[model samples]
Target chain A: MNRFASAITAFALAILAMGAAPVAAQQATPAVTLEGLVKLEKTIEENGKQKVVLEEPKVVVPGDKLLFTTRYRNAGTQPVDNFVVTNPVPDAVRVADESALREQVSVDGGKSWGRLADLTVKGEDGNPRPATATDITHIRWTVPVIAPGASGMVEYHAIVR
Target chain B: MKNARTPLVLGALAATAIGSTQASAAGVTAGTLIQNTASASYGSGSATTTVSSNTVTIRVDELLDVAVSALDAGSVTLADTAVLSYRVTNSGNGNEAFAINVSPTVSGNGFDAAVQTIAIDTNDNGIYEPGIDTVITNGGSTAELAPDAAARIFVIVALPGGTADASASQVRVTAQALTGSGTPGTSFAGQGQGGGDAVVGATTANANALGALLASSASVTLTKSFAILDPFGGAKPVPGATVTFTIQAAASGSGTVSDLRVTDVIPAGTTYVANSLTLEGAALSDAADSDAGTASASGIDVAIGALPGGNSRTVTFKTTIN
Candidate 1:
C-alpha cells in the first residue's frame, strides 16, 4: 500500500471509532448500582465504623426494618455531576424515620418524591391520610458531583407492614 | 385511588382484617425472588443500564384466608329440625372454589342426625327453602366463589326421631380450598398467574352447632326395661330365653301428646315371639293383618292413639334371645 492509501485507511478507522462513542461510553462505565437488605439493630464495624450488618435473609415477618443501599462508581476517566439514584419501596413494607441518609420518598411508586410529610396513602376508610413512616413507597438521593474512579453508597430503612 | 400496578392482591393487611391473606403473581412474594433492575444517567450521556449489583430480595408472600360469618356455636333440639347457616367468605386475593363436607362434630356429644342435607343459599336470603335452593350434591364443591365475596351455606339436619331426651349433639361443617388443602409450606398458586402463592391455610373453615336439650315442658319421656325368663321360669339373660322389653311412655308435662304410636324393632340377637304385644294392658296380635297393629320380622307397630298430660302408657313385647 502507498502512503496516501494507508493515510485514508487510518482516517476511516478513526471515524468508525468516533461513531461508536455512545456504545463504548455505555460499556465503560461511569456507573451506578442499587442493593436491598433487611436490618434491625444489626450493626457491624466496617473500616472502623459501625453500620448495619447487611443480610440476605430467607424470611422476614411484619415490623422488620429494611436498609436499601445504592452504590455508584465512576469507572471511566471523566468526572460526572448531578448524580441521582431512586428506589421504589416494596409495596408490602413501609419506610422508617431514620434512613441511612437524608432522602426523598415517593408514595406513588417513584412517579414523584418528597418529604414523608408531603405524601399520602389511601387508607381502609378510603380517605387520604398523611404518610407515616410506614407509608413511604420510594427513596431517592442526589449527589452534586462524583469524581472519576470514586464510589459511594446511599441507604434508607423501611419497615415491613 | 387506583394503582395501575396491575397485580392481584390478597394481603390481609391491605384488604380485610380477618386471618385471610393476599397473594400476588407478579413474580414477587416474601421468601420469593424479587428482581429489580437499576440504571443511571449522568455526565450529559445516555443512561447506563445495569442490573443491581447491590441487589437482594427480602422474603415476602401471599396468605390464604377462609372464614365463616358466625362467631358462635348454635343451638338445636332433639327430634326437631334445625338449620345451620354459614357464610363462607374467600377473603383471599383471587377467585377460587371451596369444597364442603359436613359431619357430626368429631369431639362433640350430639348423636348423629338421621338425615342431614346441605344446600347453597342461592337467593342469598339465608333460607334453606327446599326446591328453591340447589343442593350441593351431598356437601360438595361450591360453584366458583370469588375473592372478597361470600357464599351462604345452609346445613339442614333432622335429629333422629329416637334421640334420647335431654342430650346434646353437635354437627360440624368444613370448607376447604381445593387448591391448598394439604401440606404446609407449599406455595398456594395464585388463581391467574403461574407458580405458587406464598402461604396457604392448613385447615379449612368449619362451623358447628350444639343441639342441646331444651328441657321440653310439654315433652313425653319413655323408659325401657328388660327382663329375661328361662325355660325353668327363672330370670336369665342367656340365649333361647324369653326376654320381655317394657317400653313405658309417661307424660310428665301439662300438655297432651296426640297421634302417639309405639314401635319396637326386634333386636339383632332376638327372635320375636308371635302374638306377644300388650299395649296399656290390652293384647295386640303379632300379625300384619291384625287390627290396630302390624307385625313383621323387623318389629311391631301399634297405634296408641293419645296420652293425656300426666298419664302413662306401657307397651310390652316378648322375644326369644337367640
Candidate 2:
C-alpha cells in the first residue's frame, strides 16, 4: 500500500477505535465484561488469627450468610477510564455487613446508595432495625480506571430471609 | 496620491501570521446492559460490555416451630369420659407434621388422670365425634400443618370408678414436630418439604411441656349443734328457752360439689321464730333468693353455692320453746 494511503487507513482505524460509528462504539475493540457468583463464607483460625474465606455453598438455610461476587474484566484492546458496575441483591435477602470490597447499598432500587449501618428497615413491629444485609437492594463499586486486559472483583455477604 | 497608494498597498499586502488558543469540551455519557456489564470512557466515547451469569436461586429454608394448647377445664364424674382436648400449632415457616403422645403417668410436673385413650381430631373441629376422630396409637401421627396452623387432639380418660373423692388426676399431652427428624438443635441440609432445606425443631412429643388438670368429685358433710339463751338474760336451757341452732356444712376433699342443700326440721318442743335466719353471722331473709337459703313452715332450707373442697358454710336460726 502507498504511504499516503497507509496513513489515511491508520487514521480511519484510529477513528474506528474511538467507537465513532454512531451507536457502534459500545461493541468496539474488545469489551469490558462482568461475571457474578454466589458462595458461602467459612472462617478458620490460622496461627491464632481468624481467616475468613468464601467457599462454594452446597446448600444454605436460614441464619446462614452467603457471599456474592461480581468480577469485572477489561478485555478491550484500548485502555478505558472511569468504569461503573452495579449488582442487585435479590428479593428475600438481607445484606451481611462483612464485605471484601468497598461498596454502597441502594435501598430504593438502584436509584441511590448509602452505608449499610445508616440505612433502616421496617421490622415486624413497624420499627426500624438498622439496615443490615436484609435492607440492601443494590450494591455498587466504582473503578477509577480499567486498563486493557485488567480484571477486578467485588464481593459482599448477605443472608436469606 | 503616491503616498496614499503606497499605504493602501502596504495595508493590503501585509501578510502577518496569527496564533490561536484552545480549551476543552463539557459533557457526560451513560450506558447499561443485561445481567452484568461495564462501561468506561478514556478521553472520549466508550463501549459497554455485558455478560450473563446464571442466578443461583434457592428457596428459603423452612423453620419448624411447634406448640400445644389445652381445652377448657370442666367437671368429670367417676367412670365418665373426660375429653381432654389439645390443639397443636405449627408456628414455623414451613408445613410440618406432628406426632401426638398422651401419657397417663404423672411424674415431676403435677397430678394426672389415668389416660385411657388418646385421639386425634381428624377434621380439626375440636369435638370428639367418634367416627370422625381417630385414636392416636403408640406411634400416632397428625396431618401436616402449614405455618401458623393447628390440629386439635382429644384424650379420653375414664375416671376410675374407684377414684376417691378429693383426689385429682392430670392429663398431659405432648406433640413433636415430625417433619424433619433429629435431636433438637441439630440441623440438616435439604431434609424438608420439596427437598428444599430445614432445621429440626422440638423433638420432644410435649412441645408445649404443659399438662391439663382434672380433679375428682369433692365430699361435703353437714353438722348440727345448738346453744341456748335464757328467757331473761344469761345462757340457759329451760321452758321458754331461746335456742339458736347452728348448722355447719363443709367439703372435705379436692373437688367441688354444686347445688348443696341443707334442710333442718324445727324441733318438736320449740316454736320457730319468724325471720330468725342468719348465715355466716349475716342476716338472711326467709326466701330462697336471699343468701342462698330459705325458711318456710316445714323447716329451714339453705341452698349454699358450690362448695369447693376445703370450704365450709354456717347457717343459724333461732327457735323459742313454746
Candidate 3:
C-alpha cells in the first residue's frame, strides 16, 4: 500500500512539471518590435547676382524655329520607374521640327498620340489623309522608367503658324 | 477518488489560465515591428515664366487738303468748278480702302450748276468715263477711294462779275467718308462734323493798287445897299437953330469885301454951318464938314479881307441941317 501511494504522488508531480516547463519556455521567447518616424528639410537660394544683363527673352515669330526644354531631378530617396512628361503647344504656334523627339503629334490636345506623318482626319471628301504639321499643336514624351535621385531632359521644336 | 481527481483538475485549470494571461500581456505590449525604412522628400524648387509682346500703331501720314481761291463772273460759284487737290499715303502697316464725297451746304452756292459734269482721272486720261472715272452720285450717293490714293474734282462757278463789282468771292470746301469706308486720302475728309469751319481762307485782293481823285472848284459873290433919312422938313434957316440928317450904308455878299469908302457932297445953295461930322459911324471932330466953306467933306474908308459866304457889314453917318 505505502509504495503504491508514493508512486501515484510522483506521477502527478511529473505531469505538473511538464506543463510548467512549456509555459516557462513560452515566456522566455524574445518579442519582435516595429517603430516609424517622418522628417522634412527644405531650403532655397539665389542662382546668381549680376548688376545688368542683356537677354533676348523667348520670342515666337512667323517663320522662326521654336524650341522647348524640360529638366527634372529625382530629389527623393526612392528610385522612380516608368516616368513620363507631356507638353501642349500654344494654339497660335505650330509644330515645325517634328523629328526633334521620338515625336508623336496630338491634334486633340494630347487625348491620344500618333506619328507626325500618320495623324489624319476625314476631309470634306470623306477621305482619310495624313494631317499637316500645322494641325499638330501638342506633344508628349513617355520614358519607361527613371532611377532614384536621378534627372532626365526632353526637347522639341515648333514653328509659329 | 472523485475528490482526488477534482484537486488535480483544479490545479491544471489554474496553470492554463495563468499561462494565457501571460501570453496576452506579451502580445499587447509587443508594438509594431519594423523590417525596412523608406523616405521620400520633395523640394521647394522655383520656376520663373516670362512673356514678351510687340505692338505696331498706324496713323494718317498725309491727307487730301483742298481750298477755293475765289469766284468771279455773272454766274454763282459752283462746287464742281471749285477744284480741290489732295494727297493720300500708306501711313500704317496694312493697306486700307477709302471713299470720298462732296456735298453742297447751300444750293444758291451753285454747286450743281458749277459742277455740271464730274470727272475723276484715275488713269490721267483727262476724260470722263464710267468705270475709269466713277460717278458715285449716279449709283447710290456714295464714293469709293483706294488705299493711298489721291484725286481732284473741277467745278464751274457761274459768276456775275458784270452785274455787281467785278471782284472775286470765296467758296467753301468740305468732305466726308462714304458708308463702310475708311478716311479719305486727304486729311479734310469727315472734317467739321461738329458744325464748324473746316476750309482755310485764301485772299485774292492782297496785291491790288489804291484809288485817286480829280478836278474840284469854289465860287464867291458880293452886293451893297444904302439908306438916307432927314431929321427935319424944309425950314428957313435961323441963327443958332440945328437940324439932323442921317446916312447909312450896308455891304452884303458871298465874297470878301475890303477897302470900302463913303463920301457926302454938300449942295452949293446950302449955307455953310458946322457943329460936328461923323464918318462911317466914327466920330471925326478934326475933319472939316461940307456945310462949312472952311471944312472939307468928311469921309473915311474901311478895310476888310477874306469874308466867308453869307456875311454882311454896316456903316452910318449923321449931319445937322441949317
Candidate 4:
C-alpha cells in the first residue's frame, strides 16, 4: 500500500538524520495520554455587541458537551512506523463530531473501521441501514510514521446522553 | 550535528466547538459514572509496543420535575357528594416523593364544598373505591415514586346545604417534590438518587390544576279542571253536551325546565269538538301541525319548550258527550 511505503521512507529519513556511522538498532516506543473535559459557555454584552466565552466545568448535567483529546509522543531514539491510536466511545455519551485528523469509526466494537457514511448497522426494523453517530462504538487514527522525538494530538467532541 | 526535533503542545486550546442537544429525562441516569481510556500501538521492523492512557471518570447530576392534572368534568349537584379525581406524575430523572394538597374553598366562588376524604388509588386502578383505597391525611406526602411513574388520587367533598342552585365553586390540587423545589437550577446537595446533587428542572418541581362543581335542582307542576253545558243553555251532563277542560302548567327551580309538554286523552263516550283547542288565549288546529296545541285521534297535545324558573303556561279545549 502507498501508506506502508511512505512509513518505510520516513523510517529511512530518521536513520539518515541521526548519523551514518555503525549503531545498534533500538526498539521504537511512543508515550500516549488521553483526557476528558466539559465546556461551560457564557455570553456577555460588550460595546453594543454580544460575546461568548467558555469556562471549565464546575458541574456537568445531561445535554452537556464534552471533549476527548489523545496525545502521542515518540520518546525513543528510533523512528516508529505504522503508529495507530484507538479509542472506545464511552456508553454515557454519543459521538457528535469527527476529529481534525485522518479518522475512521467502527460500529462493531473496534473489529473494523471506515468512514461513518460507509458503515451500516442493524435497524429497529431488523434491516441493515446507514450507521449514525449513535452507532459508533470506537474511533481510530493510523499515522504512517512517527519520527524520533516527534509528537502530535487529536481530539473529538461528544454529547452527554 | 543534531537531528531535527518536533514538539506537540501539552494543553488543549481554550476554545471548543459545541453540538446538538438531547433531552435530560431521556439521557444518562443521575449519578451514573462514565469512564474512558485510550490505547496506542506502534512498531518498527520486527518489534511492536502498546501503551494505555489514564482513566477518566464523570458523574451525572439529578433533574427534578413533576406534573398534576384534574380528571373530573365541569360540575356536581347541590347538597350532594362530589368526587373529584386527579393524577400526579414524576417527570424527573430520579426516584422522588411528592406532597399533595387539595383545597376545597377557592377565591371568587359562590359556595365552598367541604372536603370529606382524600384517598390514593392503592391498586393502581383509575377508579376510587372507598373501603379498598388508602385514605391520605390532608396535605400528606406520597411514597417514593420512580421516574415517569404516576399516582391517581381522589378527593371526596360534600356541597353545603342551602347553597343556591346553579351556583358554582372551584377546587384546586397541587403536587410538589418532597426533597425541595424552587426556581430552575436550585440544588440540594447529596439529596438525589445515588447521592448526587438534585437540581430543579424547567417545571420548577411543582404543578397545580383546578376542577369545578355546580348546583342543580329543577321542577314543573300542572293542574286541571272541567265544566259542562247543554244545548238549551242549561248545565247538564247528557248526550251531545259540551264539556270545556282547562289546564295550567308551571315551572319552578333554579335549572332549566326543558321540553315541558301537556297531553290528555279524550274520555270514552266523548268526542273532541273540531277547531276548539286553545293555548294561552290562542286558537289551535285540530290536525297534528305546528301549533303548540294539537287535537289528534290519540289526545290533545301541547309543546312548551325551555320554561325558565317561575314561569307558567295555560291550555283549554272542548269535548262533546257522544
Candidate 5:
C-alpha cells in the first residue's frame, strides 16, 4: 500500500513539473520576431538652361540640336516598381530623339498614345511602312523594378527648324 | 510553482505589450495599410514635396490734345485800327477754364494807334463804334471754358473811311486759367502765352502827306499771287519726274505775306514719285507722302521757306511710281 501511494504522488508531481518547466523555459528564452521595413527616396535634376535662349541664341541657323537630359534617382531603402515619368515639350520645340525605353508614340500633342510598330506612314510607293521605335518622339520607361538606391537617366534631342 | 508561472506569464505579456505599442506608434498593423508603411524598429521619419512655377510680363497705352482757328478783319482803313473776330474752342481731353486777352505792338512806319479803335463790338452794325457793332448781337463773350468749350470775340478800330489802308500789325493773345492752374490738373500754373500776327501791307498816305512823299505818280498797285511753274517745263512732265518747279510766289499787296506754303496736285492719272522731291533748293526727302497712289495727291508739300512781301524760289523733284 505504501509503495503504491508513493508511486502515484511521483507521477502527479512529474506532470506538474513538466507543465511548469515549459512555461519557465518560455520566459527564460526571448521570443523570436520578424521586422520588415520599406523606405523611398527620390532625387530629381532639371537640365534646361537657367535663362531661356531668346531668339534661339542665333545658333548656326542652318541646323541646331539641343540635348536635354534629366536624371531620376531612386535613393530609397526599398525597390521601386513600374515608375512612370512624363515631360512636356515646349511649343517652340519638336522632339527629334527618344530613349531606348520608349514604348508608344503620341500624335495629338502627347495627350494620347499608340504603339510605335502599330503606327503607319504612307511610303513613297503609297504603301504603309511599320514605324520603328526610333520614330517615337516620347518615351515611357517600365523599369519592371528599380532596386533600392538605384538611379536612371533619360535624354532626348530637339532640332530647331 | 504557482508564483513561478505567474512571473513567466507576466514577462511574456510585457514583451508582447511593448512590441504592440511600438508597432502602433509606427502606424502599421498586421492588416493592409492603404497608404505608405514603415517598420517600427526602423523608427519614424517624414517626407517633403516641392513644386515650381514660371514668370510673366505686361504692357500699356497713352493720350494727346490739339486745335486750330481762323480770324478776319473788315473795313478798318487806319494801319493800327484794323480789328478782327475769332472763335476759339477747346478740342482736347478734360476741362479748360481760363481767360484770354490780346494786344498789339507795332514797329516801322505804318503804326497809328490814335486812328485805331480796338473795341469789343457787342452790337451788329458792320462798324466797331457804339452804334455799328456786331459781336454783341452774336452772343459771344470772353469767359472760362470746360473741355470742348467754345467762345467768340470781336475787335474794332477807327480808320480813314477812304483808301488810306493800314499796312501790317503784330498781335498777340495771352491766355490764363481763371483758377490759376496749368494743363492736365489744378496743381501748377501754365506759364507764357500763344498767338500769331500778320505782315503789313503798303499803306496809302494821307492826302496832306501824299504830295510830299510822292516822287512818281504815287500810284501803288498791290497784288498777291501764287504759281506752280515748271522750272524744267514741257507738258507738265510725269508726276514723279525729277523736274524743277519755279514758284513766282509774291505778295504785291500793300501787306506782307506770312506763313506761306504752296501745295500742288499731281493731277489725275499721276502718282507721287516717292521721296524724290525738294523745296526752296533743299531736299525734302523726310516729308510724309501717304497719297502716293491715291487719285487725289494730298501729300504734295512745298515749304516756301517764308516768302517775304515779294520773294519766290524754285524746287525740283524726282520719283518712281508703282
Candidate 6:
C-alpha cells in the first residue's frame, strides 16, 4: 500500500481508540458514588462537660463503641429516584442502637425489615423469641430522590462483639 | 452535632464504662480481620444501577490479663511444712506466659513464713508430687498458657518453731503476664499472637491472691494423785490401808492427739486390787479387754484414742498396801 493510504489508516485507528476511551470511562463511572467510613466514638470531658466525639479507629477491642457512616452523592446530570442504601453488620460486631430514625433492620439476612421489638428469632428451644440488637444482620435507609449535585449520609452505632 | 440522643445509648455507655473496670477475659481472637461494605441502588428512569462503597478493614489486637487464686485451706500446724496451693490463669485473648512471684511475708501477719520452694503441677494434678512436680524459683515464669487456661502451683513454706497457736500468716502469690504489663491500654507492637499489638487489660495484666495460714499445736497433759484410807476410815498411809489413785488426762491446743493412752505403774509396797479399775466413774474389768481401762498387778492402764483438744478424761483405781 502507498504511504498516504497507510497514514489515513493509522489516523482512523487513533480516532477509534480515542472514542473507545470516553465510552469506557462513562461506563466505569457510576451515577451515584458511595463511601463507607468507620470511626471510634469517644466520650471526653471538655470544659467539665461530657462531650461525644468521633475519631479514627486506630485501636478497637470488644465492647468498644463504633460509628459507621455511609455517604452518597449524585454524580450524574439528572436526578435519581428510589435511592436506597443497605449495609450488613460485620460478623464481629453488633448493632448498638435499634431506634435510630430513618433506618430499618433485618434479622433474617435482608428477607424482612422491621423494628427490633417486632422481630422474632427461633431460640435454642425452637421457640420464637424477640430479636435483640445483636440479632440485627442488616441496616437500610431509603430516600425518595437525590437531585443532581446533592449529597446525603446515613450512620449507625455498633459495638465489637 | 446535637447532644440530644436516645437513653439506651447513654445507658450502654454507662454500663460499658463500669464493665471496663473489670478485666475482660473473653472475646474474638487476636489479629482477626473484620471488613465491612455498603451497597447503594438507584433509578434515574427505567434503568436501575447499584454501586458498592470502599471496604473498611480492621484487625483485632490482643488483650493481656492474668489471675491467681489460692487453693490452700485456712490452717496449718506450727513447726510443720505448709504447702500453699494456687491456680494461675491466663485471662487474656492470646497465649501468654506468666511470671510467678510469692511474698512469704505480708503486713499484719502474726508470723512470717520461710518460703522453701515453689513448684508447678507439671502433670496437671491438684496434688503436689516431690519428684514429679517441676520446682520453680521465685520470680520464675511458667509455660505459655492459652486463653482461659490455668496452671496449678504449690508454694512450700515452713512455719517457724515456737510460733504461738492460732497465729496467722499471709502469703501473697502474684502472676504477671510475661509479654508486658502496665496501665490499662498499654500496647506492645508486634508482641501478641499472629504479630498483632498486645494491649494491657483492666487488670493491668497482673493479679494476686493471698493465702492464709493459721498455726495449730496439739498436746495432752496428765496429773495423778493418791488418797490413803486405813481400816478405821481415816486418810493415812499405813499397813493394810487402801490407796486410791486418781489420774486425769487433758488435751489442749487446736489439733487432735491420736491414740492417747495413760498408764501408771503400781507402787512397790502396794498389793494388787482386782476389779477396781474405773474410767470416768465407769467400772472396768480386771482383765485386758475391749473396755477403756484395765487393771493388772503390774499397773493400771487406760486407752483414750483420738483425744481432741479441749477435752479431758479421768481414770481411778484402788490398791491395798502390802
lDDT of 3: 0.33
Error of model 3, residue A148, in angstroms? 2.4
> What are the per-residue Cα lDDT tens digits for candidate 5 across B172-199?
3333433332333122212211111111
Model 6 chain B: which ten-residue window has the lowest total lDDT? B13-22
Please give, for residues B1-322, the per-residue lDDT of candidate 1 as tens digits: 1231322221211211111223232212323323222334455354433333443544444334466553225454434566767677765434556787776654666466643678888888777799888788655877766555778877776655545455666555667765664453345444321233534533322322233322122357789899999888889778889998899988765334667788879999989888888887788887665466776678989777766668988988889988
Residue-level lDDT of model 3, residues A1-161, one tens digit each, is 32443354356446645744664464342111112221111122447643422223121112324344555555444444444444444332345655423476665545668887667654447787676665554565555544555676655554322
Q: What's model 4's lDDT at B24?
A: 39
Q: Give the DockQ-based CAPRI class for model 5.
A: incorrect
TM-score for each of the candidates: 0.54, 0.56, 0.26, 0.62, 0.21, 0.68
Candidate 1: count of backbone clashes, pairs at least 3 residues apart or interchain: 14
Summing lDDT over every window of 10 consecutive residues in candidate 4 chain B, give the lowest-scoring window.
Answer: B8-17
Best first by TM-score, ranked: 6, 4, 2, 1, 3, 5
Compose the digit string of candidate 3's lDDT tens values, residues B98-124: 333333234333112222333444665
Off by over 4 Å in 5: A1-161, B1-70, B73-82, B106-109, B112-141, B159-166, B181-186, B189-322
Q: Quick one: RMSD of model 4? A: 15.2
Comparing to the true complex, what docking class would candidate 4 get?
A: incorrect
Stretches > 4 Å off in candidate 3: A1-55, B1-322
- lDDT for model 1, please: 0.58
Q: Quote the B-chain TM-score, candidate 1.
A: 0.52
- lDDT of every predicted structure (CA atoms): 0.58, 0.60, 0.33, 0.71, 0.33, 0.78
iRMS, candidate 6, in Å: value is 18.8
Compare candidates 1 and 4 on TM-score and give the better one. Answer: 4
